[model samples]
Target: MRTRRLIIGVIIALIVIIGAGFAFGALHKTKTNAKTVTLGIMPGGKQEDAIWKVVKANAKKSYGIDLQFVNFTDGDQPNKALASHDIDLNAFQHYAYLKSWNQSNHGDLVAIGDTIITPIHLYSTQYKSVDALPDGATIAIPNDLTNESRALHVLKNAGLITLNSSQGLQATVKDVKSNPKHLVIKEVDASQGPRTLPSVAAAVINYNFAQSAKIPASDSIFVEPFNADSHQWVNIIVANKKDRNKQIYKDIVSAYNSENVKATIEKEYPDGGEKAAWDLKF
Candidate 1:
């Protein structure tokens, strides 16, 4: 009887331990499954939606991450959303744009992953070519600092204007030391560049905006070079400085930098509008 009692006690203890182990595992699994993240993106056209679906599905299947997207129509909102903790990450702006935003807002957002490079182009509906631009002709550029500087660079490269080299990426219309064409560079909201085309002789437009406006790649008079330096304009997945190294964020980056996503980008924007930043190092 003593031996039987001892056996029963041992069995009861083993059962309790096993039950606790199972419950603990279940709790851990629930915690792991609950992991999710929200990313902000500028609302591109249908292509953007399709690509996001692919990303979302991929992340869900591979990492069990519940990836969510918050779309912003305004170029300025994504970073602001991220800064305010409204979104966990944003995959919209390039390094130059992000840098300018941080400096202006006194924010500490950092890029955790590189995504793509959308070449900025000079598009004109009135003038078929750069040479056709007349003296004192109006040209619209992005109002934001980084893009305004970039637009000036594009204009400088096109020989329509020249900029102070020392100003570099910070160059503005004021840095235009020479405008032989007497071009009137108008600063407008970046999203307004394509819309302003009807009123201006030409406009330096970001690829996404141009695409959104249904502007064709062939309509561009000048396309920014896709080289080493141009990689600085590659769009990135930005996170708050403190969250930069989290494993979930790293997984998100890995998911974005995958071949499936790269292939989708190439397929969606085959006209050189959006080039995947596959070569970019994180």
Candidate 2:
């Protein structure tokens, strides 16, 4: 009876050990199986919503992984979050802005894929067209360096002002050599440009902001010329330089640039959709 009891004890111990091993194996599997990636977006608007919807759905279906989107209200926030390792990836900034951030901040951010080019437009409530603006009309523009230069370029393009020889792409209000309209250009945050339109004689706004405010691109008094130079304004998918070769990184770009996604963009964006979308060469 003692021997029998000893054998039973041995069996019970083995069972316990085996069960613990299985539980550990299960935990390991769970850790490996939880495949998820997060994407940081600009904000919650129809344009952003449409892009996320197609990209997220395709990412899940094609890669058998989950894609999460976190929304930020302004352009500068995502880069800070990325540098802090708060997110896996972000897709809200144009290449020009991204380059400037990387140069200034010593960030390791890498652009894996180029996304859409959100054209900038000069919208006005007090004027029918850029030509109709009276002399000394006030114009509100984004205060950031990159956008401020672009805004000045738009005004120059409209024959309202000209930049000095020393004034380059980084030019500001001080660079305006000749203001034909005597336009008092006011620099404000890009996100607030939409709301300031009714107050300012005219406001130059990024496409996404205008879309969020329900302002159609066609209604803008002046829109940026769509040319090769404008391609720099295209948004890009960004991740840490270390994650550039990860499978999920490649999958995200694939999902976003797929034929289905292209079709959706074509159908939605006023631009010809995928083929004509002002994105980088795949």
Using TM-score as the measure, the top candidate is: 1
Runs in model 1 with CA error above 4 Å? Answer: 1-17, 29-34, 71-81, 84-86, 131-138, 188-192, 195-200, 227-232, 280-282
lDDT of 2 by residue, 1-282 (tens): 999999999999999999999999999998988789988887755755886798889988888779998889877888889878898899887778888999989988988887766567899877788888888889999998888888888787777889886755667899899886788899999999989998888999877678668875555888777654466667788999998899888899888877777766767775532233434442
**Candidate 2: Cα lDDT at 188:** 98
- Which segments of model 2 are wrong by more than 4 Å? 1-34, 71-77, 134-137, 164-167, 180-182, 188-201, 208-219, 266-282
TM-score, cand. 2 vs. native? 0.71
Q: What TM-score quantifies how close candidate 1 is to the native fold?
A: 0.79
- What's the lDDT for candidate 2? 0.80
RMSD of 1: 3.7
Cα lDDT computed for each candidate against the true fold: 0.86, 0.80
RMSD of 2: 5.0
Question: What local lDDT does model 2 show for residue 246?
Answer: 90
